[model samples]
Target chain A: MTDAVERIVNLALHLAHAAKPVGHESIRRDVFGYPKDQDEAAYLRMFERDKDELRAAGFVIEANEAGLYSLDSAATFVSDVGLSATEIAAVRAAGTAALSDPSFPFAPELRLALAKLASRFEPLEVPAASRQADESPSDQAENAAALELATRASKRVEFVYTNSIGRTAAHTVEPYGLFLRDGRWYMVGRDIAHDEPRVYTVARMADLMVSGARPKSPDFSRPAGFDVSAFIRLPFQYGDQEFSAALRFDQSAAWRAKGLASGLGVLRSEGDETVWSVPARDDAALLRWVVENGPGISVDAPTELADRLVSTMRKAATLHG
Target chain B: MAKTPASERARRLLAVIARLESGSEIPLVDLAAELDASPTELASDLETLSLCGVAPFTPDEMIDVFVVDGMVEVYSPLPALDRPVRLSMTEARALAAALQGAGFSADDSLVQRLEAATAREFDAAQAERIVRAASGQHAKGVYGSLAAAAGAHRVVTIDYESAGGAGTSREIEPHVLFAERGAWYVAAHCRLAGAERTFRVDRIRSAQENGESFTVDAADAAPRTATPSGDLPTARVRFDAAGDFSARDWPGARLVSEHPAESGDGDIAGPKAVLGPLEIEIPYAGTDWIARRVVARGGAVEVLSPPDVRAAVVAVAESYSG
Candidate 1:
């Protein structure tokens, strides 16, 4: 909790998590370099720091009795949050229903997506954003016109967006990700202005044009490590808390540990075992990770890290059972 | 200058514009009183005339315009009232072409205007051909049908068939009709399905509205209920460069984060890579169409998703394979 402890744990957690399949001794060295007088308790503090740090980083760290740690595939990997089946269904249903809308010309690829979504979930209840949209005729017309253009364009589009502060920026980007952010729909793209990448709110757009330009590709990549929700808050990213913790995993479950993110680094293939080095901004996500991975994965380096996942799992199981 | 012959409309309008522009230093209230027209109407005409300047015929010809204390005035030597000489053949053809692209460009007013203006049997070279190509007649018919239903608020029964040819009869309470993708769709509350729906007019075998009347929505309601580009859930896709799918340009995107595709990191130069190049996220309305498009691109493009969208793409691929 103190600043010094938090700083040390934070560094240790990042070092541990940045690389996948991190070794126990390497993690310890990452924290203490060389132990003073072989004091085991000092090592324990380091472990406490590591676990706490992982929790703070939003990592779910769990240790098996054997002293190896792993991340939970289910808990940390999320494209959607708090979405009910019904909501998903509604989105799918409404989307599919407009297939015939002439203004919004959807290509076969788009139509297939609608059909697929419709089959998966029930109709989603209209969110406040969607309902508010319905309240105005102009909004509906604009959306319709955009749909028509997008359907016919069926290719990448380029748009110029002025930020909330009235700054003008341009993005010659493809149309890839469309999701509502706080009730406003934003189109995510690689910003041509910064030449990096960014998101633009649909409502903020002044003009939208589907150009004859095709999706000219760049040789860039997402680092394979990007987590969409990390943009929501800091606690969910690196180590959850300020302490180091240890975790263990059964060597048999090593193969189950693939790369959770591109930057999580490589999966070291050792004899009958695998270790994951994780840097976390929050430990809750880490804790959840270990509980879900169960006996197969654990938080091995920092002792406290191992203990947290075990206790959380035990509690969770008890509550459910 | 030759003796100017002015019509009643031109004379009345010119007097109004002349007074506003002359700036007799006369107050706008005084001019309205002298003109015997409402100050509001006179002001509006003056304002409109101010915008109507002759293109510079010579260096001395500045745009003849005047604005003062909520009053609009214009100075022009030409007649004050000229409604574009009733649409030149070229212009008529252009309008018709614009209409035909969406398969509808006809209306009762349009018919009346065309009849009164053209009066000729045909202007085959310029206007007639283009108008025909635009399908001005057809689009008008489809638009009129839906417009009538939407105006009447009547539950209309339609014989419908889908892409796969499943025909059914349904009565839907038509609300608004929209033109999209060169077709017309009537948006309404489907009485049988108990939900809002859009019916593509081309898919309808027959449509008839029972005797009914409906209230006109407020003017502000026109845009909000409009349908989107597609009926599918949309996903954002940012591209490195706009690919084969053309007809639009995106100016909003700037940069992109990307990596080599999962299977084909080394494949670009040789046969080592299985997957192709990848780019950032931009929202796309339909994946099914995109999947086929991606496939058709022959390795020029790739799709990236958070996970489920990727899964959906895979599922679509496998299903399509069958």
Candidate 2:
């Protein structure tokens, strides 16, 4: 119903007339997933519409009684053109998480939204946001059921929450939105208990069922002086705790950190190393940040944190040695 | 019950439409009888045909004309009809989704093959349009082709579906065939194995040479025969009250009673919440299924049924612990 239809049609016409006796059945099955006999009506209709559409679209579909419906290239609805089913899958796959879907709509959703904006797609070719790939068949079915439930009720959820790392926790949340980022999946919502907006990793969720409680989103006034732009760019979330610590990054790493700023850190430069006064509460998260920054960055303050960094570096060195 | 050549009739009628549009006219009685359509049906087809065109609004639409004095004598080349064979964006989306689900895509060479095959039936733009909107989960590659071969009594070579991906390729006499999740699979007698084996067509690496054919035994093609020993054990898990906190996480798991007499309140009322030391089983094959199921349950579900399966889940959980 969106832009994907138009683009795929163009692609299909190109495929149909690409070779001698174009194999339309392959299109129906590979592209359309319909059985050969089931698409008979389609074949009939093709005769009625081929010329005008083909010529206009530049596919040059001819009709012959050989090949699939025709062998003669001239008689087929499509003339010489190129590509295969797998290649098209690869192409169309980029837009939808269903192609590379892992779990949850975390970052993949952002990427899909950004990608869509970048492409300037024909509204008709706008494909459905793909589902995260790697879901077992039954999981897909469950997701479908969940989506349907969401569409029908327009409410929040109480689900056994599974973290991206496969840790399980239970949360009662108002389902606000669903998105896919990279290959990961996430569902954004207001945690009903906490009454704050939170995102749940979908693949981690076990007993997921959409709640029936319908709560209308209130009139939104952006929180006064809230930094929306900074929030959007920032990746990691700071929990209840905040840390004021200093980091010394080498010039090369500092330049990359300042320019990219993919995630956290209150970045500032001092001397040779850029002194980043980063805010991360606990040991687990702080450790993660340090590891990601690589060997160049060193924890200057908080001897415990610095020790952790040194120990981590020592482990890396041992491995390499 | 015969197929009664319904498809053939549908094919014939479409041909007549194509011929008429291409400026060929046929006698009414002859066309009607050939199509097995009654006089009224033929008249209806003609009436529908009368309305068919790019639309008389544009001079090009009015360019084609036909006169029915006594019988039906159609005339002139009608440009492609506006109401010609076309699919909606929704339909196309379903198709694409289905194909994608089945592991087919438009960029592959098959897309071109599909175009050529359906060319006689569909115009380039229309076909392309339909395919672009298409979405389905069906593997129409080697699997579908093999199934077709099996139906034709053709012996084909294919890898057997076993543990480590695909097995060695062997010549097989494919008999019974079925489709699972839009992919073709055939249960056939493998010459080497001398036993009936189910083969996934997509796993086949080479072209299926239509070897010396044989007859298919119709009686053996029943949908699901009872197994020799139907010992399909459902996977079960048991966890204490600590586990019950995360009970809702496991999909398809029904929390049974730790206490039969006492009732639960709210959603947990009437044994909705399985008490600690609970038992749950998920029916499936292989340890992978158990691992996935157990992992999904997280801290809530503990394995109780099928001791080996429980052990497998514990092992999988331990792997994650590291």
Candidate 3:
């Protein structure tokens, strides 16, 4: 008997090569997977599953009112985009590197994608870039599994999460989206217990399980306009009360503002200086950020905040003296 | 066989078929490398494909593909599978996520160009919002230039600004591009420094390929840590109870001791009560980097022994006060 993979490929080829929509009798008689002596109900169920699998693989198989199926070539085949050498190199480099990175959450799917695009260009001579940073492979695996369920499978997941303050509790969340920040993975989801959306660190999660009920149907619909990037708060942006903080980057270090801002604040050029107005929730963290990134940066507005920074600096200088 | 999912194999088979449909003979090793699969796996996939066919399993209807002398050849091409299939939604998402991880934003031109090849149902905007891998707004142009130069074995001139706000121009032979923590670094042979150093790509103000090619020595191209070897100078520091300081903040730091915060030692803020103050001995290769970190924590951390480090920390704090 042919395996499921072989059977599915045969079904796809039969549909795609057919001159016209083929009926069920023709498929069962022609496809290699369905056994001739198999029960009628079982054959029908298997055939339906194969078609669904084909659809999931991006093949648009259409059935007419007469119950005939044909592969929609226009939708199934990608048209030539005439990619330039530079564009091809970028895709090849990034795809090749990420495919081998164990910490990347999408290596399996990326491998398939790169394999599909392999025939388009010549083999690149450059070695793929590698990640040298510290990473927890278990955390990455968990993140990938939960992300697939939350986004693609649209299933609810249950896990025990330990918060920053060392508190652990069971949580059932309808995961909406996922984002990576500062070498850590975060999932923004709706907590079933609180009935509100919350972000949880993937590393601190333990014993995660996705809802297995209704494999095809989604358990919940993500609310409209929900974006994971919005939940990616900067280091100093975490706290209850928020305030507008301004910092000035001297002309020498002005170029670093955009990369440091991470698309979270308003940056404008004031003569030779770049002034950034960003939201701050943690004053201490903000002060630390300025010092760590500085020599050319300083607090510019909210006299109280500036005074506090000066005071802190004076104390530091006195102690170091 | 049970370990590998059926759907994954099916995806690989489809790509294999698309690659072989041109009827060109390709070495099994080369093909395996291209598809990121082992030769044995490719051989098994080929055997499976050779048996797959429409009903009746006629010789003409079946896929006539096989490996001859470790080379893949296709005698009977299936016209339907000639063109590569459009990327599935999951595959497209993976591509976007990978590109973002490489410092390319969702709106980068490279991403937009690749979007044209995705399935019609793939929503680029939605994918951008749903999954984000890139942490910050990186200098994409700088990263691209350095990456290209590294690939071509070329020397490029760059104006790099250090964390201390000092800028210098240098010509360097680009070697390997790597990511540590959240930032991208290029390990290159710096002519100015007369050594192989890792410079953060974000700190590079501008990079211009000088059109001069250079050869990289094996030793020079090897990844090097900024930390210097040998008996290094160590600094003893104390952290206040209110600060969330850990050994991770200072690599190669050893915990000296922990003690309860003495009354009137310092003011403690925030909701969490002060557990204790920490004293650590941290080794340093240079005073500049350690001084910046100490000053960054403000008054929460203070340098104890090593008068040079303390003086350096004071200088850094004064630089900020000015």
Model number with the top TM-score:
3
What are the candidates' interface root-mean-square deviations? Answer: 30.8, 16.5, 3.8
Provide the TM-score of chain A alone for each candidate, in the order shown.
0.32, 0.43, 0.86
TM, every model: 0.30, 0.35, 0.86
Ranking by lDDT: 3, 2, 1
What residue pairs are clashing in model 3? A30-B54, A30-B55, A31-B55
lDDT of each: 0.39, 0.42, 0.76
Over A109-137, each residue of candidate 2 has an lDDT whose tens digit, in order, gives 22322221221221111121233233453
In model 1, the number of clashes is 189
Error of 3 at B226 (Å): 8.2
The residue ranges of model 2 lying beyond 4 angstroms of the native Cα positions read A1-321, B1-94, B112-232, B239-277, B286-288, B295-301, B308-322
Q: Model 3, stretches more than 4 Å misplaced? A: A82-86, A125-135, A314-321, B21-37, B52-78, B216-243, B256-289, B299-315
Q: Estimate, for each residue in B1-322, the C-alpha lDDT of model 1 and write its tens digit.
A: 3322222212233323322223234456645543444667556544433333222223122224454775444444432211111222322333333333333323334333333332132232333221122211222233444444554355577766432224577877666544432234566666677766656555565666666654445431143222353333434443334243221211112124444434322212211212222343333333333443333222233455445555444443332222
* TM-score of model 3 vs. true structure: 0.86
Minimum summed lDDT over a 10-residue window in model 2 chain B is located at B82-91
Going through the candidates in the order shown, the clash numbers are 189, 102, 3
